[model samples]
Target: MSANCSWRSSCGRAVWRSSRSSSCSSRRPGAARPGRTDLASVPNGQAPVLPRTTRLFQGRVHAASITHIKPPSVRAAVPRRPAPEPEPSGAEPPLVATDRLRKTYRSGDLETEALRGVDLAIRQGERVAIMGPSGCGKTTLLNCLSGLEDPTSGTVRIQGTDLYALGDRERTRFRARMMGFVFQSFNLLPVLTAAENVELPLLVTGVRSRSAREQALEALRLVGLSERAEHTPAELSGGEQQRVAIARSLVHDPPIVWADEPTGNLDSENSQDIMALIERLNAETQKTFVIVTHDPDIAGRCHRTIRMASGQVVPEPVTPRAKGRARAAEAKR
Candidate 1:
């Protein structure tokens, strides 16, 4: 064999032949040695025998070519999944909703119906006024809707959660957390100062005294009653007392405020001032308001009015000016 003649083994490792001999030698089997081959070591007309473990080119074997093995293909019988239901479009769930709400008061054989299948929806941030003549169930509706009183039949939902579904204690706790109430009577304690009155809600909810005091002061400041925080309800004027009551209602930052004749006890100027303050609060905080009032002026100032009579909602015609104002408000939003 010529000294330059060489060939690679089937294992891909280089097998070299000595210049003086035809036999091939490798440093180790299966080790690569570039620029070397074992072709020269093969006898004239015969191929060299390689180790049994060696693999040939194209997956072949020296004695006989081995067939390529493949795994059988499988098709799983997977059921097609059903498509998802489409979500509602542009339809916001009501912040407050009542369905066929009814309230009946009974005394011995005498029974008085306060609400009769009143279905209503109040959107978030809406200033809604409920107005009607005396014996119209306005106060009863407010009480039922605020979770303060139980409805005779049907559902009251706040923020999509059914208020009446909760137990009495749970409902009370939920109201403390989710609602604020402003009454015409200005229900502040006689002994507690304005700040203490404002902080009462927080204390009931287990807030620390110092923190509650700070929050109370802040709430008072919001209502421009910071200077009067130290004054008791007795020392405060009627208007100032009402302002204190407003502060107390808002101190906890509830999302919904139920005002039942908030300005009923105030003079005309004071009533205007209170309504202005309420409007400012609604504009600033976006808190939803459900005000029960007989005053058309107050009702007109609200974004919408709901009139009730004989325990049923009476549909009122929308004036062009009111429609224009509503459109303008919606456009601004």
Candidate 2:
């Protein structure tokens, strides 16, 4: 409490020397205090140093202004958002589309070209049949269009998403969410019952068990196999198994369905029945159907047939009935 108090600073540096008669511990209301010790002041364009026991605050230290003493609160930084997917530039993009689509398989330079620049477009809710002779890239085209196989040198867009551009896991998830596939082999697990087989797709998508079961039962009923829901694949006949597969395909309620010779293993009666069921379902659901088949009878039932040969779409042959029908439609118009 001395009248002449000075800091015993090292290096013989004296920052402040208040020549006041009053002591600092007992100062009046308007008494003079020390100078430039607060962070807001910067005299001589330089920061002043204080006592060793005193706290050093930031003001104009060197060149940059620092506000280190009881600074105002600032909001936490928010992360930047990711860029959105580039939307397809069209009034309505095709449900399934391909441009210059090609697929080739190579086993140590033993190459086999399965698809050659196949340009295809299927609109939403259209039942389109793809018919071709054996080994004519029907299955390969189906696989490419449905995102099951990647084409070597072309693009496949499903619902405006680039199929190959997605990673494997993302593409698989996209397929599980947006597509349904029915194969010729009736690829049902032997241990699972018909209902279990039907619900597998829904279950994979994180649908609740009760909801998945209800949807599976509804899909089975749609395919006319509700009564046989408890039967295993071995217990069901070939036709019934295929119906179960069809039920499984539809269980997820996807917008597009792909069938690769779905009735190839069934008898003629069963094939007819299955095709009839498919036609009815297509009418009811208004879902896009892309069926790969060689049977003329099955191809004849669709809205139009796309014939493939040598990995290319050949022109469809116009039958006389088609000409007559076109003329009749023209007359009606």
Candidate 3:
């Protein structure tokens, strides 16, 4: 038997035969060739021929069947999300709002409640006056609302911003940007001239020196103190000094102006003049004004008056326009 026999039996067993014959005599009638299981049976006289598709490797026939498999697609279809709709702009927020504001001052067991749950709202471009007797919490309410002092509890929202939510330094900077304050003492530096005093706020807020000077001069002129710009506080009269203070308060053109006892140190005539100036400014600039005063005459000029007593606001008649008219009539008498 030759070792190069390429014949296989029906049970997949090798059949040895002579290599020159090209056929195996030991192959049975139903025998299947090696790696060619698809071949049909032949007659006893006819020899089975191997398929031509089979390849010869190392003197052995091999039949290979290949099946191609495709991978899953890398790109997938995704659904897109829709965008959010914007809110309507018709409804405007209040310029200032306070909710249940409370302030307590404690000094070594002496507890003083300055504000007892004050809830207030002031609209934009409105002139509001706060009036009450001494120690009635008017000043405390002003201080708390202006971010000058923190409330014991409750929220102060100025132009939709929570004032106490910010740190001390940030609150100071925000207050400087959004508010102008006027005090009864005219809080001007004595050494600085009128223009310099008015320019102080601008300088504090990082305005350029030249622009600050120009703005200071414009504010002084608005307050009718253009001629007194070079004069020191000592050289000006009491009314002129107050005018300078007004100029200083308005030099930055803040949205809100807070005046604490603005007419307290002035006489009746000077008080009337100062109140008129404030009214004019409020009308011209459309700025919100919150003034704390004891003078009924001064309070009458405001658009609305809020009266307080014992750390709470008292119910009052809404006769702001009538009060102004009455005061004007009384002045003529």
Candidate 4:
């Protein structure tokens, strides 16, 4: 009975040893855990003692990894830019306009009113001839309209902007950009060639030298003087020189061209040539021409004519003599 009892005790000890060995083998490297089948084994002495729940283990892993990961680079937000403004339309309203324009000068005890409430509308693409005898405010009205001199009491608008309110520099810039002038004197620089003389206005308006020369060549060609592009005023004939002056007026492609006595210095043949060139340019380019002249034939050839006498535009009188002359002139033309 004692031998049988000792043998039973030894068998029980062997069973406990086998169960502990099996448990230790299940937790060995690369072996499955008790509740987590997907959990991978770590290196020797580096295995983590994580919580039994999957969520807690994952959360702890994420928290630990965040310390090693760098923060994302931050950048300043940029602002969106606004769109540009639209330009004004519809022919830009004539480039020049006058409303009851008046100009009077007082010298000591003498008083002379050059312009007396002149109401005028000079639109784009229209050729106009202001014809009258001498000393009738043609030059005075031009000066006022060009912003070279302000009216005594009136308003003048250029490119739909008020000119009388502008200061001297602004007025000068406006003139350079929006207007061109020609005169009988052929205001060419004595030292410059024909192309250079034509480019003067572009230089004033800030056109680069290369582009200004190209534009000057084009202006000369438009006036049928491409061959004389290098000639000086002294080298050219009176007609050719006047054409050069006209080209100079057109170099910047100004919207308004005002010519005062453009052909007064030329003979009849030269006058006819200059007038024909002006007419052609007006027809081809649709540029506005406001010519002040004493020549009735030149005025009659224009599309519209305004007769100014004593600072007032005298209406065409409905008389038999005037009617007969008009009919005769029409027949001749």
Q: In every candidate, how many clashes are there?
A: 4, 0, 0, 0
Lowest lDDT block of 10, candidate 1: 65-74
**Model with the higher TM-score, candidate 1 or 3:** 1
lDDT of 1: 0.83
**Per-model TM-score versus the true fold:** 0.73, 0.69, 0.69, 0.67
User: What lDDT is reached at residue 62 by model 1?
Assistant: 30
**Per-residue CA lDDT of candidate 3, range 40-139, in tens?**
3443334344332334678775543433212122234588888888777765689999999999999998999999999989978878999998999999
Instruction: Give the number of the best model, judged by lDDT.
Output: 1
Among all candidates shown, the one with the greatest TM-score:
1
lDDT of 1 by residue, 1-333 (tens): 123333335555445422223323534576534334355455444544432222344544232222321112223458998999888887688899999999999999999999999999998888999999899899999999999889999999999989999999999999998999999999999999999999999998899999999999999998999899999888999999999998888998999999999999999999999999999999999999889998989988898899999999999778986898789888976
* Candidate 1, position 234, lDDT: 87
Candidates' lDDT values, in order?
0.83, 0.81, 0.82, 0.75
Off by over 4 Å in 1: 1-88
Q: Which pairs clash in the backbone of model 2?
A: none
The better-scoring model by TM-score among 3 and 4 is: 3
Which ten-residue region of model 4 has the weakest summed lDDT? Answer: 1-10
What TM-score does candidate 2 get on C-alpha atoms?
0.69
How much lDDT does candidate 4 score?
Answer: 0.75
